[model samples]
Target: MLAALVPLPVILPLLGAGIALMLPGRRRLQTAVTVITLVVVLIISLALLFGVDALGTQVVAVGGWDLPYGIALVADRLSALMLVVSSIVTLLVLINAVGQEMADTANETPVSVFNPTYLILCAGVANAFLAGDLFNLYVGFEMLLGASYVLLTLGSTAERIRAGVTYVVISLVSSLIFLMAIGFILAATGTVNIAQLSSRLAELPPDIQLILHVALLIGFGIKAAVFPLSFWLPDSYPTAPAPVTAVFAGLLTKVGIYAIIRTETVIFSESDLRIPLLVVAGLTLLVGILGAIAQTEIKRLLSFTLVSHIGYMLFGVAMGTVEGLTAAIFYTAHHIVVQTALFLAIGLVEQRAGVTSMRRLGGIAVLAPGLSLLFFIPALNLAGIPPFSGFIGKVALFQSGFETGDWLIYVLIGAGALTSLLTLYVIGKAWNLAFWRDPDDVEEPTAELVEEFEERREALAAGKAWKAKPSVPRTMSLSAGAMVGVSVFVTVFAGPLWDVSSRAGENLRSPQTYVNEVIGHGDGS
Candidate 1:
């Protein structure tokens, strides 16, 4: 029965989501259930973080079925750490949603129903983390994505709907590509189970294996928003409700990165994918961040940043070494936390400013000093400034790149440095406009307050004077608090967390320990 705990991370959220709907619609009751369930899931994730074998993997067979036929849940270091990070980000985002009566950005929808939907999303993410087979991974992706469809379009405004349709369509196509890739894999190898396929993959001819690898790469690359397949991301992400946007920033693309890592390191052990990933990674970083440099909207800038950083993780996977993979894993974990916090902080800015464009916004420091600081810290961390988690992650990644001793890798490192600087410059440009600039820098003809006052005065002339409300968002305070808290946690505990990430990377590259443990090798207790 204890062994059955392998499935709990996935099942817990699914179970809790059902129970949440069963509860009465009282806000307090719903919040309690969501908080408690998420907390429990977080605890399980942390337990796995500590208890899972650093060098081994664990698997649980459902319904007592044998390996090939039964559904299995596997947890190695990488999945456990991902589960922990995902659970933490989900809880923090959920808390931010509940604390502020989180409203839809485009419209005024309430936050009550968001609880159940968010839990479903968490469950789907957990399933993806724990799934032991290719088909099950697809099921997890679909489950999580169906939840995402709701999250992305929660408010039902016209722009949101338009953006949501693009998001949904792009997502579905990626899934279809993934399914097609899996079909090819199953056709060639005759099994969809990862453990089963692990043995069988080596039996296939090298050329056929490379084709399957390329197929998987293309499909997952689209999901990761890798270069040439990344255009849909910036368009859709900016319009989502704030918390939904935050979670998407944190979790969604990383799932694609996780799949890419798993396929390159585990299912397809050949070094064949390295040079291709090297090329993809370099291009992804250059193209995505360059797109960011061209953006004026704060949210849009972060969206491009998300696409850009995926390249760092890809860099790790492409090196195909323990140092490289571990560094990549570390970078992935750090970026997930940092990215989620950054988006959430930006959500606060949008909430208060009532607009996302830096051109139309200013004087946040005057009105929201706390929030300005919150935004500033994460923005700096994201640009890889020192003493923050992002710098540490980037250093680890850069080390791996240099160790490869490839000139292209060095050039990629130099390019990564340039991208970091550009990222800082773009974010700095936003900061200057929104916080540092004089009011005279307004893009429009008049300051917002002045314009609003004039409109009110004109209305008064027509006897229609209603006092104008300030643009500050109600959830603004909570969003800042959540993101700031995450940044602090990452900052304060960098050492232990880095160690955990290192062990996770080690587990991923040489999966024999994981496979042997999952199959209950001769060391059976």
Candidate 2:
């Protein structure tokens, strides 16, 4: 029974996507199908999480072919947890999108295009998490890239199209590199199955192993947006519609991070890439936050901070210890919720004010107290304020570094600390400029900014700016509020979640367990 549940997370969304596509003109029915599919996925993911914890790793070989040749879907603690969180995030973002469509008659994000593509994106994410082979993971990345291209350029505006082009080019380059790495792995080890590669990789020459490992890292690195490879993200992500941006900010890059975690822990378990990862983590942190401090637009700032916090997850991975992996898992979960919530909240700001530039936004605290509260909670949470999950995750990661006692890790600890402080400063600056000040005192928008805003408004709906309601739709606010609540739930349940993360971390550090479950049993027991 538990084994049967492993494949549904990927299958159901795909089925729903097809069904949604068939119901082209029935927006209500399409939404019903999409919601029911995701809600079921959420329940199954929660069951998988508990089942994996109770029953140990669950693996299902597709079509009953034996491992090393057939495709396999495996769910241990890490993948199951990711599935649960992702299901939750995707469902809420969908709700937010539905609300936006209902409220905005201009059809900024057409339901016909959005629903099916979004479901496909969810299936791709599930596939990536459950993929037990390198080639399958590449397929998952392609699924995401294909869907994201359509979603990113939804408006067909010149600005969005340009950003989408840059995004597609960068993503295609990364995908090609990933495909090459898969070929190299297959050529070198005679297998691209992760479990088999685990043992076979160790037998190859050290130099060959290092080359394969670095190739894989570079490919995944570009996707994860680790600095240097991160320049495309800030520009690409900020141009999408609010719900699209929210989901992308929250989930997409993390898929790359997840792949990197699997690569470091399972395939190259003995390789010592720790020091280099640490240096990269430090640079990622400093460089990303520095970029955030320089941004005036709310979405752009959040985008930079998104890159900055990826550093924390990378920092935890660089520690290369069970404690470190645990913290990385926890931080990944926390960042996903907090970051998605922040974007949704900012989406509300954009909807209400018709702009997200801090210089032009003010008095939101008085005008829209609810939106203010939604943004305030996640902003503080993202900055690692105490009593929130962000703080809890950061503290756990810092503790893991301290446990390592390496001077370089010590320097990273300092970098993480500085990054946190600067995050707070930037969040504070945005709050003061956009929320705290009186509307009358806000700076007037420049002609260029006004022209851009007008273009966007017109793109969203030809002339609806004059006819649309001034107040934000309640559904949009509720969706954002629910996301904020989930972030809080993570904080309240930090203890149990940490314990689960620790177990997942322990499982990751012990590659033999994964191998034994997938290959040793041979029947996918």
Candidate 3:
């Protein structure tokens, strides 16, 4: 079972992709495959979590070759927890996308686009978590980026195309950096195998190892959108379709953070670089939120906030302690749910009010009371108010950072809290402009070319024909409701998830165990 488990995450989806390709074009089949795949992934992740909890971390060498001779797949608490969280995010958001099409209800924005690519993306992510070699992790990342390049531009609207191109270009550059970094690692250690590198790494002198670690950091840093490298994120993410935007917001970047956490713990644990990471984390948090504060558009604002929160996870990673890492892990899980909900809710609002531009939308409360409430809860949750999972995550992260009694961390925590407060204010600004203000005063849109807009939207909505809309489709409302419901679950289930997250943190801090399982007990032991 353990040997088989190593391949399940990757194998299942590739098989599903084949099935989806052969099935048909209805998209219903695609939805079925995606939902089932996500469910299976969730179960596998949970199984891995509990299995680790009970027996211990496990690894399987591909082709049954010995360590340093073949690829490996590893499952530990941290990876398993992330797998489950990401699976849920992807599944729910994909459903949200399909639900918006309204083929069953009224003619919506005229399309439906949930299918095999999303499944392939999920498969890629699962493979990333399970990969026990550096090159394999790189392969997983490339697979996902390739799938996402299409997803990001699913609608092919000019704005989305422009944003998608920026996204692809930036990601390609980062991928190249990652590849070069891998080459460096391979050169230094003569193995692309992660477990072997771990043991071989300790044998190398400290100064030489630091060089390799720096290269990896730059590579993952680009993906993590660390500080200066982060500008691409806000630029590219806001323009994707709703479901694509939501998944990108919630799941995609987290993959980067996940890689960061993995490499920092698994590959660079011996380096005295936590302080540098801590500084970078603090800057990312402050800068990201501050950027949000300046944005007038709802999607752009959310993008900024998203950048800022990445800091919390980095803080946890930098702490290098079990408690700190656990807090970060917990926060990561919590954020994924909340972020997806927020983005989906915003998408719903955009569809209902007929605009994503905050300047153009107003007084949704009059027309969409339920929608307003849906939006409010997630916004507040993302702002980290009490009784919400976001709050719990922030508290855990802050507490962990403060425990170190490092003034820098103290400052970072204080700033983080302030950013949370202001995140509330900025989102409130959007809420105020979009929902609370008078609706009647909304100037009729001057979209003389909106018919063309509908035509393209219809095509991207899955090649369905749709007439110009006098009214918004109800399916958008239903999709929003489903997404909001998931957010509520996160707010409610903060306890059990946190427990699992803490265990993940503990497991990650003990990387020796991960290696032992993957490569088997080594001579060093």
Whose TM-score is greatest here? 2
Residue 159 lDDT in candidate 2: 90
Candidate 1, 1-525: lDDT as tens digits: 335567888888888778777764566677778889999999988777677744356677766777756676888788988998899889888877764465332243344457677888999898888888888898888988998888788778899899999989998898998999899988887778776666678888888888887888888888888998999999998898777788898889999999888888778764366777888898888898999989888889899999998988898888888888887887888888888887877777676666778777776665567778888888888888998878888888888888878998898898788888888888889889877775555674235535554665678798984553545444545655766676778778988877877777777777666555555522221
- Of candidate 2, the 10-residue stretch with the lowest lDDT total is 445-454
Q: How accurate is candidate 3 locally (lDDT)?
A: 0.77
Clashes in candidate 2: how many? 0
Using Cα atoms with residue i matched to residue i, what is each candidate's TM-score against the true structure?
A: 0.91, 0.94, 0.89
Query: Model 3 over residues 106-205: C-alpha lDDT tens digits?
Result: 2222223336677788888888888888898999999888888877776567888898888888988888988988988888788877766777787788
User: Would you list the rank order by lDDT, best first?
Assistant: 2, 1, 3
Candidate 1 vs candidate 3: the TM-score winner is 1
Angstrom error of the Cα, residue 421, model 2: value is 0.1
Instruction: List the candidate 3 regions with Cα displacement exceeding 4 Å.
Output: 102-114, 440-479, 521-525
CA deviation > 4 Å runs, candidate 2: 102-107, 445-470, 523-525
In candidate 1, list every pair of residues with a backbone clash.
none
